[model samples]
Target: MDKLTIIKIIHTVIWVFFNVVLFYLLYSVLINKIDKWVWICIGLILMEGLVLLLFKRMCPITVIARKYSDSTKDNFDIFLPNWLAKHNKLIYTTFFVPILILLIYRLISG
Candidate 1:
């Protein structure tokens, strides 16, 4: 592929890898409790949301991708404002609703 495509792939891979490692650490080490799995799951989901928001808004890799796309005339669009991109209320609600419900159920049942 071209330089732009290569850069985009690298950026995506790095972000995914970072998130996986971060979640692993959080679940395995930071909150080491069987009962905390619910909290861990919720935290991971929220972290994913935050990463999505960052990718949409102020991610350095996304900024680089935007620059490369602009220079090469690629069809990548990454020019979202920080507020709209990072704090997408709809996405946040959609992702967390199920997790919140599960957490509440677990708490009440247990």
Candidate 2:
């Protein structure tokens, strides 16, 4: 309906897209289907990490969303629960790193 709302919606879409890609990469690694797509997914995630760093450890979308509304709700920018959204990076990295490391080890040893 408004510019900020549209931007918030776009931000949420991108946030969801990032998680979808991350999960798909995880699925590929777990299924032993790591291939070019997996590398591409990793690259995407790295770029996201870079963006996070650039934004002072906040997602660019989240920063942009701050200008839109001051809802202060966890799901304001993304579709995650309050607690999960707050700890998304830590939780995902905890799981993602080990799996990715194991997959990379398998790749390297093969």
Each candidate: how many clashes?
0, 0
Off by over 4 Å in 1: 10-38, 48-59, 71-93
Q: List the residue pairs that clash in candidate 1.
A: none
In terms of TM-score, the best-performing candidate is: 2
Local accuracy of candidate 2 as per-residue lDDT tens digits, 1-110: 87666776786678778778888887887788878988888888888888888889887777777777788776677656789878888987787787689788779977
Per-prediction TM-score, please?
0.42, 0.83
Candidate 2 — worst ten consecutive residues by lDDT sum?
Answer: 72-81
- Superposition TM-score, candidate 2 onto the true structure: 0.83
Q: Give the per-residue lDDT of model 1 (tens digit) for 54-110.
A: 777345555666755655322242233445445544544664565455545555765
Deviation of model 2 at 65, angstroms:
1.7
For residue 91, what is the lDDT in candidate 2? 83
